[model samples]
Every structure is written in structure tokens, then in C-alpha cells.
Target: MMLLRYLSQIGKYFLMWKEIFNKQTKWPVMKNLIYKEIDDLIIGSLGIVAFISFFVGGVVSIQTALNLNNPLIPKYLIGFATRQSVILEFAPTFISIIMAGKMGSFITSSIGTMRVTEQIDALEVMGVNSLNYLVFPKIIALLLYPFLIGISMFLGILGGWMAAVYGGFTSSIEFINGAQMEFNPFHITYAFIKTLIFAMLLATIPSFHGYYMKGGALEVGKASTVSFVWTSVTIILINYIITHMLLGS
Candidate 1:
């Protein structure tokens, strides 16, 4: 029933990936597309990611401080909590959900439009593997997605520090010490692992939606919305599964 439909979709998605690499588009052409996508997908999204992430981190710190009403709680706990939340969850998972809306919609609508306009058909008729030409470049471009997440992690902590100090929740010394205290590089590794997984999802899921979409402009819009929802859900579910697998006790 519904379960089978989902399972079938999953199978088809993997099969598309297999075909995507079967014989890639020419290096020169793919290289240009890859560079363009890097600009569009990675460089283009930096501003929004930085702005939202900074504020969110600050809010997390302020909330943590406010909740610790008891005098017994050390002020540095604000920094500690913010670090754990941002590095482990906020930057990697929540930010990815946001991108699933922004980038996923773009991918879906762009491809869906091409589908509607018969551009994909023309490519197929010319013996070109449209999926590979269209999607592999996006996948290659998103490999740099970890770098974006890295920036988010740094800015998030910096914003938390600023908010906590300016808001009188803690002194600069206390916050700095707390942020560096008990630091585990493994947490960063975990975050980057999740970022890489998310990058693949970002490229593929939306491409799948757009590539398989039918009909005209109206359907493209519908596909974009549907792609965003499914992409977000898939990301959250995978975040849980990967976290449990990697960090579970």
C-alpha cells in the first residue's frame, strides 16, 4: 500500500543515481555546470545561513540563561549549552531543513520547467544521459557544503558569546572558558558527517522530484512544494538515524 509506494520510490531513486554515473557528461561541460552550481548553491546561500544561524545561536544562549534562574547554576553553562546545541543539531540539522526549502524548491522548479519545456526530452533523444548531466554537477558542487556548515558553527558560537556577554548573562571570560571547556573534536566530525549526508540529499531528492514531474507550469509549482516537504522530512529522519548510529550509547 502506502509503504510499498515509498519503498518503490526509494528503489527508483537509487537506480537513478546508478544511471547518473554510468557515463557522465563530458568533462568540460560538466565542469562548467559544477562551477555554476557551486556559485548558485553554495556561495549564493551563505548570507542567509550566516544571518539566521547567528541569531538562532544568540537566542539559544539567551533562552538557556533565562531558564537557569537558580543562583547555583554557573553562568558559563550558557556557553556550554549553546555549543552543544549549535554544533550537534542546529547548524547541521535545522539549517539543512531551511536549505531543503530554499534550494530544494529551486532545484525542483528549474528541472520541472525543463521537463515541461521538452528540454530533457531533447537531451535524451541526442543520446545524452540527462540525469547525469543535470544532477551529477549539483552533487559535485554540494561536496563543499561542509565548509558552509563550518562557517555556521563558528558564527553561531561567536554570536552566542556576544549575546550572553551583552545581555549580562555572563562575563566574557566565563563564556570563553565554557566554550573551550571539554571540547571534543569528535562532535565536529559528527556535524561534518551529517553535513555531507545532507548535501547529497540536497542535490538528489529535489532532482528526483523535478526530473520525474509531469505536466506544465502549474505542476512544476506543485512539485517544488512537494519536493521541499519530502526533502525536509527525509533530512530530519536521517538526522535521527545517523545520530543514533554514530553517537548512541
Candidate 2:
């Protein structure tokens, strides 16, 4: 029964996707919507992203430094480990999960409210492709998600350096050298790939909950909560799958 229910949902979701891009929106309207969404979703999220990333990076560095008590372990390893953690996993995947909370709730509640208010029905009555109008702009805006993640990576590394130097864990030169050593451009590529996938999921999953929700004001809150949980789960699962496929399990 559960499997069947999920299959039905999958089919319905695909149907939604099918309608999301059938007719192009007017260029002027779309342009304005896209810009607004970019400001709302991307630029609006910058402060929290920077705050968490910097502190988390510092914590990672501190923990790495403390764990390497052995004399044989080089001090520069603190920076190196922090770099790997921040770039490969923390900045991209974990931060995305955080966004799932903020952005997902907004998407679900807004859409769910529209659903409850019969706004969507009115759109359909008017022959408007509401999903395309509402959700596509969000998806388009999040195409810049990789850019956000890139900023996270830089701030994370900077935070690590600050913590390491201030905490007297390592010399600045040593940390810089270690971070530079054996730097692989492919890591950035992998991170961006994950960011892009997560971006799509971000735009759609919450919209799904809100769009399909069948209830009143109270239910919109419920839908938002459900959307956040499901979005987080989907992201974690996809992260694991992508990691296994790309880097081998």
C-alpha cells in the first residue's frame, strides 16, 4: 500500500513537471519574477549562510587540531582536513539542508495558501499555467545556487584559518601551504554538481507539498513542516547516492 501510494505521487509529480514548461511566459513578466525570486531566495539567504559556514569551519578546524595529538601528525593537517570537509560536504550538502528548512517552508506555505484560497483554481480558470508562473521562476533563480555555495567554501576556509591562528594551533604559513598542496579542481566541480541537483530539488519539493495540499489555513503549516522533512530526506539520500556513484562506495 505504501509503495503504491508513493508510485502514484511520483506519477503525479511527473505530470506537474510536464506542465511546468509547456508555454513560455512573457519575457517581461518572467524577467521581473526571476529577479524578485533571486533577491528573495538567493541574496536574502546570504547572511545566515555566511554566519553558519564561518563558525562551523572554525569548529571543524579546532576539532581536527585537537584530535591530532601525535607528534608524527603535521600541524598543517588541520587546514587540509577543514578544506576537504568544508568544500566537499559541509558547504554544499549540509548548507543545502539548512536551506531546505528556510526556503522549503516559504515555498510550501505560500503555495499551500494559494491552494487553500482557490488562487490556483482561478489561474486555471483564466487559462494561465500557474505552476510555470509560480515555480519556474524559483527554479531559474536557484540556478545561481552554485554561486552561493562557492561563497560558502571561501568563508569556511577563512573561518578555519582564523580559528587555527587565533587558537594557536598552527602558523599561518603552514596552514596556507597545506591548503594549497594537492588542491584538486575536480572537488569544486563535484561540489557544484551536487549544488545544482539540490537547487532543482529545492525549487520543486516544497512547491509540491504546497501545490497538492488539500486543507485550510491550519493545513498550510502542516504542509510546510512536511515539505521541510521530505526535502531534507531527499537531499541526504541524493547526496549519498551521488557520492557513491561519483567517488565509489
Candidate RMSDs in Å, in order, are: 0.9, 1.0
Clashes by residue pair, model 1 = none
lDDT of 2 by residue, 1-249 (tens): 999998998798889888889886788999999999999999999999999999999999999999999989999898899999999999999999999999899889989999999999998888888999889999999999999999999999999999999999999998888788788998888899999999999999999999999979999999999899989999999999999888774
lDDT of 1 at 128: 94
Cα deviation at 139, candidate 2, in Å, is 0.6
lDDT of 1 by residue, 164-232 (tens): 999999999999888988999999999999999999999999999999998999999999999999999
- Predictions in order: lDDT: 0.94, 0.93
lDDT of 1: 0.94
Report residue 112 deviation for candidate 1 (angstroms): 0.5
